[model samples]
Target: MDFQFLGGASEIGSLGLVVRDQGRTLLFDYGMTPTDPPSYPQPAPPTIDVAVLSHAHLDHSGMTPILSRLPKARLVATPVTLAVANLLTRDALKIARLEGYLAPFTTNDISSYGSRATAVDRHGTFRHRGIEIEFTPAGHIPGASMTLYRGAKDILFTGDLQTIPTHLVGGAESVECDVLVMESTYAGKEHPDRKETERRFRDKVAETIARGGKVIVPAFAVGRAQEVLMALASSGFETYLDGMARAVNSIYLSAPEYLRDSKRFRHALDGVHVIEHPSERKKALREGEVIVTTGGMLDGGPVLYYVGELYRDANSSILLTGYQVDGSNGRQLLDEGTMTIDDTTIRPMCEIGKFDFSAHAGHSDLVRFAESTRAETVVLMHGDRRELLRDALSGFADVILPANGPSFTIE
Candidate 1:
């Protein structure tokens, strides 16, 4: 089997890969970088037989519509993933237009991709172009998956995996393969213990509320927003849900089986106030409340509105609950003590806190996963600490750090 790393090789975003065997080519995850003017992967081969999407995140499925232009392309992903991808892709197009940038594809292209999509169940095996393919739950987000290809040599692609179970999704299932292509997002980093982290988060919110100050949690609309809602609800807090998260909440409710506890998730939604109008959002801001909004990295969304409103209040708190990529407003706030929203920059007087509510496996978890798989070779991607992971797994397997546009053959 010949594997080519088209993108997402040394960077944390814009993941794309191509696999060729027996005169058939399969593409895996054609995504875009999450930058101001979001760069994309190299042009996809003209005659891709199958394009498999691993999840709904823009960095993993953003460029999928490009494949729609190919006459023989057939898209494959889990049902929920495909649905969420549709939502995210449409949102990306809107963002592109709002930012005055040229979108890579049109709504019609997304529709065409949807028309060509085939939904597969998690852990189900299917044959395509004489190659055996299977998907296992990746535990990163709802419908995120790890793709397994069986040909001359068995290969596994870990697409943004998380082995630790969260309120929304269960832990990733372990699998064995000869060559393992895995994400190293937090390969050498250790997160705070889950229970401790949750306790600290709840305590902070409680303290803010007690002080007659509002607690604003900036989260990703898809997975992190729901997780924050569930966490707050479980901790006996009445929260407010706003922005694109409301739409995602509806989608999550529609697909109950994808979550860890559907009933609990529904209960969380029941306990929260959903902000449906601008007026309602303004009203919520007048009182001391816990509010969760979209745009986790603070790139844009209702978070900007909340930040602008709360920045001057020293008693108010803004909690960031995810990884802040470099150059994002979230990172700027954390590193430089200021946030830029549009043309205006503000140094908020509010208390700022960052929590590790990440959906990726940490150092110990990555080591456990690597040792469990017992693969002969482990290829690390999607992170900057490849050397750390290589050193950690040196005795367990042969480690290979690959760059973009290179082909590695598995023996």
Candidate 2:
């Protein structure tokens, strides 16, 4: 058996890998680079029988529309991932346009991706030709999953995982495998207890509110938005959610079992203002004491309007609750101690705070996962090198960190 690391080998984005056993071949992910200009990798081989997606993150599943043009390829994913991915692809088509065309795939690709798609749950398994596969909960997003493939050899691919219990998803599944392909999004560091992190987050918000300044929490519209809402509602302050959170929350309410505290989400959301209009967003920024908005990286969202106004005020505070990828306006704000909007660089007089309420496991968690899994050849991907995920896996002699285009024999 042989595996090709097409992308996501030595980087945080565009993770694609192909697993071949005798006459059959299967690929994983198929994402584009998240940075500006949106890096596109080289083309794939002549054919692949199946394309397995573990989640709906742009990095792990973004390139599916691009790759599905390869003849009669089939897509395998969970039901919610398909729903979220369809929305994500449509949005990508709208946003990632170049010269009046989406470089990888068009709206036609998004629509066709659903045609070749099949959904599987935790206990369900599928067989393509001779290879057997299992879908296990990844404990990341609503429908994120871990896949186990067994043929001449056994392999486990963890797309992006979180073992700890969160508001929306269950804890990570401990499904065993012989070759563990895991993501190292958070490594070489310890995370604060979810309870403590939320506690600190509330205290920080309270402090900002006491000083008569509104609090801003910029979040991603996916899983992160739900968690932030739960934290704020339980924090004893009036919290308002704006923009994409309204529409996404409605979808999340459609599937209640996947959440640990569906009642809490609904209860916490009661009386919570859901802002979608621009004037309301500005009014919320001007009047609301505490606000949670999506577009986590602060690239462009209602949060920008809040930050552009509130950031220059020393009494205010901005709370970042998720991972900020490189080149994102979030990182630029965090690193530069200032951000530019409409060509104006505004120095933030507001206190900037961060909480490590990361959904992904840290270094110790990854090691524990590796030791428990039965996989023989472990592949590490995801995360920035500054997180030291690559170095942290050095202790595992079986671990391989593939660069783009590298191929290895899985024997």
Candidate 3:
């Protein structure tokens, strides 16, 4: 058996890894990179026999629609992942529409992808030809899973996952294998206390509101948005959700039990407002409204319209509530202090703050996880820190970090 890291070795997204024995191949997590070298191509004949997914984050799962066009392919994911993946692909298409980027996969592609997928929700052994596969729950996203592939040689594929469990989900059981293809999203860092972060997040939202400013928060449309909404409600503020947020919340409802506070999920918007389109943003801007919008980076959403409307005002606040990946407008604004929205250099006059409510596990958690499992080799991916994983790990020298496009022999 041999393996290749098509992506997700040096970077945190576009996580693709391939494992092969003879002519048969198994790819794990077909993700798309936000920063485009315009890489990734349509697979040739024989193609990828089966692709396994861990979660629905775009960085980890976006390229599937493109790859699904290949022949004799089957996607294996959980029911919850299938539901969320469908939502993500559809949303990706919408985001692409505004950015002038073509979606690699069409609705039809997603449909076919969904059809070929065999949703499994169990802890058992499954066989494909002579290869043995097993999936365990990965506590990153609801229904997220890690797969173990056993053939002549044994290996595990860790999709983007959290080693330490959070309120929304829990981590996977680290199984023993020759190669552990794992994620290191928060490899070098430590996540802040959930209570502390939520308190601060709430306080910031309230402070901006109390100052009579529209607290513009840009969040992803999935888990983070719901998390922020719950935090706002706990903080006792009226949250005004805009863009695809309200739409996405319905999909979130598809897995209410997956949430830390299921009842709270439904009522987070009680005092809050929901803006479906750009026109409704005026009222939120003219008057001080705690507005939550999609396109988390102020890219291709009503947030940009609101920023254009109120960024000049120092009194306004922009609370960034998630990871701002590089090159994204959110990261540019959060890091550079200046941005060109609509070809205008809008120096960030508004107060900008970031709250790291990351769903991924941090440095200590990863160490704890590795130690608790007592796994011999821990493969790392989905992180920018190469040296961190190497230096921080204590007990293992076989922690493989495969560079993208590099292949490895397993048998």
The global C-alpha lDDT for each of the candidates, from Candidate 1 onward, is 0.88, 0.78, 0.72
Error of 2 at 132 (Å): 2.5
lDDT of 2 by residue, 179-200 (tens): 8888877666778788888888
Q: Which candidate should be chosen as best, given TM-score against the real structure?
A: 1
Error of 3 at 6 (Å): 1.5
Models sorted by lDDT, best on top: 1, 2, 3
Model 1: worst 10 consecutive residues (lDDT sum): 123-132
- Per residue, candidate 3 scores C-alpha lDDT tens digits across 1-411 of 677777777787677777777678888887776443333422323588888877777777788876567887778877777778787778777667666787677888988888888777636456676767888877776677778787665667767667665555555666666666667777678888888887887777677777777788888776677667777775555567777767657765776655545666677767677776666677666654677777776666677777887887887799998888677788888778887777777796889999987877778877666655555666777777856876766456467666777676644
TM-score of each: 0.97, 0.93, 0.89
Better of 2 and 3 by TM-score: 2
CA deviation > 4 Å runs, candidate 2: 98-102, 384-397
lDDT of 3: 0.72
Stretches of candidate 1 off by over 4 Å are none
Clashing residue pairs found in predicted model 2: 177-374, 177-375, 178-375, 178-376, 179-375, 179-376
lDDT of 1 at 277: 88
